[model samples]
Target: MRIGILTSGGDCPGLNAVIRGAVLNGIKSHDFSFVGFRDGWRGVKEGDIFELPRHQVRGIAKQGGTILGTSRTNPFDGENGGPERIQATLDRLGVDAVIAIGGEGTLAGAKRLTDAGLKIVGVPKTIDNDLDATDYTFGFDTANQIAVEAIDRLRTTGESHHRCMVAEVMGRDVGWIALHAGMASGAHAILIPEVPTSMEQIFGWVREAHDRGRAPLVVVSEGFVPEGADAAFSSRGVDSFGRPRLGGIGEVLAPLIEENTGIETRATVLGHIQRGGVPTAFDRVLATRLGMAAVESVAARQWGTMVSLHGTQIHRVPLRAALDNLKRVPAERYAEARILFG
Candidate 1:
């Protein structure tokens, strides 16, 4: 059977690994031929694609980004777009199935196409680990690991200058990246999008940390909203998919923190750095397994389903399961981390 694969949304650490895994598994086990769509849904809509043979995927497991490339292409745009157009394109190309590797928006679009009678399987690819169905996603570990290393490096500089360093990481609607990285880096405080943190509380934490003869370190998600503030200012703009850009929270918070606490504060936004790099060993393994499971789903014709990691095993679930709700940091988990706060 011939299959088509597309990677969508933002670039991720383990995206190349997933492509490699799928190509290797599908060819070796199922004797399947593969074609890759360029630049996400736009490629499918425009019929822009090329063959993705097994050799084309070699030595890419540790590579960052994707060989097929990606984009925030809206599948609902243009006169010749949406589910009907996509279905016709797949059928015309003689492709038997599709494997969509992306985050929530990409998966939702693919699900719509699937519901319209197209054969497709999904692989959850949120770097924030926000998808609720799976225990984890591939890029989150690599991103968190990168953030932790940056925090560790910044801690020394902050100590030398006696400054309260605020490190910002990505987490659009959740705090998984900040939470894990903060805990690992021994951050004095962690601010996330899910919790509305007040400037006064931030000041208290910095003051307490300073009194203990240590340079305070703060880790916050880019989407963090300060209490009684207008969501830490407006976003830059929306993407092609109409999702708002989430950032500048750290930059806005740092000044307020310094003014209120009388401490030198500096904000460092770790933008894009966390998302680009060789993936961690954990991420490589998980992404590979998820990719292989996606192939299995296609063989079973499990339309509108996605491969998910439940504990140590990979399983397939309905697309709705993955999109039911975002997996935000729970109160209890936050409380446990909060106890270590000032």
Candidate 2:
């Protein structure tokens, strides 16, 4: 069988590992030929691709980013897009099935195309860990580790200067990254979108930490909004998916904390750093397993399905079931972490 693969949405640490896993397993076990779409859905719409033999994907398990590259292009847009055009392109190229590795937007597109009779499988990919279908996604662990390391570094500088340091980590609609990183790094306070905190409450935490002869370390998710605010702070813009480009909450919170608590403060945005670099051992293994399972799904002719991690095992689930609702941080989980708050 001639199978096509594409990596979509924001680049993450375990992307290359997924490509390696799928290609190796497809070639070795199933004797299947593989090709990679160059830049997400755009490549598929334009029929731009390259051959993927065993040699092309060798030694890329620990590598960060993707060998096939990625983009935020919606497969339903443009004149050459939609399921009809995509299917025509696939027919011309003799591609039998597609394995899409990406976050929500990418999988949604795949689901739509599959409903139109396309053979496609999905592998969930998001550092936010917001997809409810899978117990855990691949890039979350690596991103959490990166955020924790950044907070640890910020702590030493904050102590030296006797200032409150606010670290912003990426979490658009969920606070998994910020919550795990803050708890792991021993942050004095952790702010997340699931819990809307008042500035007064944040100031109180900072003041309390300072009074205890400690440098206050605040970790916040990018999507976190103050209690009175109607939305998360976002002035940058929106992406192709029409979701607001969320960030700069740390920048907004830094001055407020300093002014309210009379303590010097600084903000550090750990932007794309969390998305790059070698993946953690946990992420590498998980991504690899998910990728191999995706190939198995393709062999089984499971269209409109996604490979998900259910506890220790990888299972295939319907695309509709996976995209039904975003997995959010439960209030109980946030409350448990709140116990460590200053």
* Best by the TM-score measure: 2
Candidate 2 lDDT, 1-342, residue by residue in tens: 999999999999898889989999999999999999999999999999999999999899999999898999999999989999999999999999999999999999999999999999999999999998899999999999999888999999999999999999999889999999999999889999888999889999999999999999999999998999999999988877778999999999999999999899999999999999999999999999998999999999999999999999999999988799999999999899988888
Ten contiguous residues minimizing lDDT sum, candidate 2: 236-245
**lDDT of predicted model 1:** 0.90
The TM-score values for the models, in the order shown, are 0.98, 0.99
Native-to-model Cα distance after best TM-score fit, residue 170 in candidate 1, in Å: 0.4
| Runs in model 2 lying further than 4 Å from the true structure | none
Q: Per-residue lDDT of 193-261 in model 1, one digit per residue for the tens?
A: 899987788889899999999999999998888888665454688767566777888888889889988
